[model samples]
Target chain A: MIENKTNKPQRDGFWEKLSKLNRRYIYMSVGICVIVPLLIRMRLPIFITPPTKSLYNVVDKIPPEDPENMLIISFDYDPSVMPELQPMGVALLKHCFAKKIRVACMSLTVMGIGLAEMATEKAKEEFPDVKYGEDYLIFAWVPGWSIVILKMGENIKETFMADYAGKSLDEFPIVDKIHNYEQVPALVCLTGSSTYLSWITYANTRYNETICTGITGVIAPEIYPWLQSGQISGMLGGIKGAAEYEILLKKNKLSKVEGTASVAMDPQSITHLLIMLFIVLANISYFVIRRKK
Target chain B: MSTNIWVWIAALLTLSVYSFLYKDNPIYRFAEYLFIGTSVGYSIGFLYWNAFIPRIVRPVQAGDYIVLIPTFIGLLFFARFTRKWTWLVRYPIAISLGIGAGISIPLTIQAGIFRQLQATMVGDFTISNIIMVVGVICTLFYFFFSLEQKGVVGGVAKTGIWYIMIAFGAIFGYTVMARIALFVSRVQFLLHDWLGIIK
Candidate 1:
């Protein structure tokens, strides 16, 4: 019989006091830790992961001034996840525009269309050289999830009759040179849910399109197997992925690049260290109290 | 964009949501209700313009009568609320389920199972790859519930439990990062966007 060893420390006076301590105090400290780093513009050392670098390489390798090497960036998140995900979407568009990679943009989710527009607004403002309809096109969210995915391989224009603003696809100069998943080199989805999985299942399998995903931290681990399988070109797992990309772009001397993700990193590192500190202190207190008992 | 009232509204709404961390108050409840109401309102409007208008109306305006097939099938969904017509709802539900299951099965097998197995089998001989290969096999062995645990198989299965625990620990660490990120973002908003403390 397998003996399951349980090592739970006895809760005594010390544990009770720590537990009863004002919750507001904890919240206040967390707030201070995040804010102090931001005000000073504190820079944190970022170790870019292999996956993040692979994503960077894939984006960097998109041949400049070539409309045929088209990229599709789909925004599939909402305001709730805007802070973590919006930076990723904005940074990716910045990279594409900076490299002059002709791209098409869409959203799988209804909530995502507004967020997609926000990302574009930020990116386009920073890089004024990027013109609408010629350089990039924005598509509206359509119902029928897999139906739309399947339609992309056939007639992408027919999939959605017009842009998000109700302008026909023919009006877009970018679509003149690029149509369907076949013409596109890479399809990137910055999503908060399993929307990336659908892209992998449909787009990658059927049309043999090279896909890259930028997902939230929660779903990032599940995507590792796919990354290892080489079904995905690259992955940006959460804002860490975004921060890594920002560091790479900054290293390349891309001026006026938004460092939002990198800025978030200082707070991220500090907060993580703070959390570990709390856990260690708690454990130490627990063990010391148990010994006294 | 100087002194945008909408920004102030957003900041207030954000604070109201954060207020729940303190205690449930009328302010939090009001904001929560308002958020849900606004989201539903916006989604309805967006679906009308983006999906309903473009996909259905435009195709009909262009004399594509074949599009009515899917439209009629969709209307069957509304029949669910009526007592007499409740039976009619099952047709759409059945159709959707049938279609969804049909689409998902082959793709799930190809991407989720077959490719996963293939990747594990043909991985290059690296430290990480070797660990992954062993971990995968052991983990698979742990799920063999039919046979009683005995000798080497039992030991391998036991090792699989450790790998599973380690994987879970990694996921938990990532989950911590994600939660911290959410809190940090709200603070970022309050500091950088609202107060303009950080530039």
Candidate 2:
């Protein structure tokens, strides 16, 4: 019922109706929007920007024989963010492993352990010879990120005693000879949350200004200053950033190399366009209905 | 035959999982449950192999009594299950928190607060960098500590808001493009790989 005193349309059933929608309608549409394009194999043109270039350069510029030049892969995302972050994880891992660089994988997020495994698997597929303890080591998921940062900085061994493979860090030649934050060359923070800031405070702060970079989803807004100030050497934020990284890796040719980042792009595009169209239509309808009334 | 059978099984599982988007059907529910079970099982296995085995069992077997401390502390996390013993969980949590907090303080002081301030203060005078520096100063002062100003400070603060808005706007725009790219990638996968509709 429209209130005659006010000119505004009745707001009844607006959100409640949307809330009551049969979830399938939304899910199916989203699924088709995602799946159909995958079946069709669409490769969208990507514009490489400074952020991605900076990320690329960071990886590219790693001194070839600097064994102390280690890259810390911090997984700070969970399955809820799997659709967005997993591809970035896989691609980043593949790049590091292919370059034959030593890596230290750790997770702050509880769910990050599985995601980190998925990344290791992707890298392992290419470099089957890369042993778990020797080539790359995963630190156990540290519960409170801030404290973990402190422990890692103060004494690496006191914070972590062993790798993920049930072997002592002391046993692994690559890891045993390390002490603290100063030994690591670069840190790649892959997250869907703000745990990156903790690293920024705890790890990157103590080191040289240019050693940290990050891969984050799109919702993050506050890190732009860090980017501009050269506090973070590079950043790959969101799926487009991942796509640009893939282009850098030249994975466009491989059939399955087109990972979830590619697959999820379809629904994302259609949904945004759909939302825009609906906004325009609703505005038009509002004007029309108002003018008539 | 074995390889082909595995391929068929995988395809069936994928289809069943994908069916959830259609509706809350049995196939989708089954797949969802399966995924949950598998994930939990995998996690339990990982915890044992990754944490318990190496940190506890092997160390003890190797005759290292020192390993018993962390091993005992980690098991303390399970105290959450017991009503009386639940308070014990705080010990490990405290230790973890202590180390994590200790690391983050000095780091944040340097990276989040100090380095950011320094970077904003000193830089080359390119057009983009200048605008950025201006934005940084105005935004910083926008949260000013000193005297109240109705006119110029307010204007600068207002301009500061605009600068932040514009910078955030660009970030948001880039985010949208990235999301769209992800959606596109998914569609391409379904078309080319699953159905073999495109080459």
Among these predictions, the greatest lDDT belongs to: 1
Q: Which runs of model 2 end up more than 4 angstroms from their true locations?
A: A1-36, A110-113, A124-161, A169-183, A209-211, A251-275, A282-293, B1-45, B56-103, B133-199
Which regions in candidate 1 have their CA more than 4 angstroms from the true location? A1-16, A285-293
Residue-by-residue lDDT tens digits, candidate 2, B1-199: 2235545565576678667556569988887888899778877876667556665687799999998887788889999999999999999999988866775566567676677778877778889878877887788777885958469988888888898788777676656655555445444444545555655
- lDDT over C-alpha atoms for residue A213 of model 2: 46
State the lDDT of candidate 1 residue by residue for A128-213, as single tens digits: 88998877778868888887887998888888768888888888777776668877888889888999889988889878888999
Please, what are the lDDT tens digits per residue for candidate 1 over residues B1-199? 2277887888898899889879999999999999999999999998888878777898899999898998999999999889999899888889999999999889878988898889999967999999999999899999999877689999999999999999897787777777878877877777777787776
B-chain TM-scores per prediction: 0.92, 0.77
Tell me, by DockQ, which candidate is best: 1
DockQ, per model, reads 0.74, 0.35
lDDT of 1 at A110: 83
TM-score of each: 0.94, 0.72
In DockQ, how does model 1 score against the reference complex?
A: 0.74
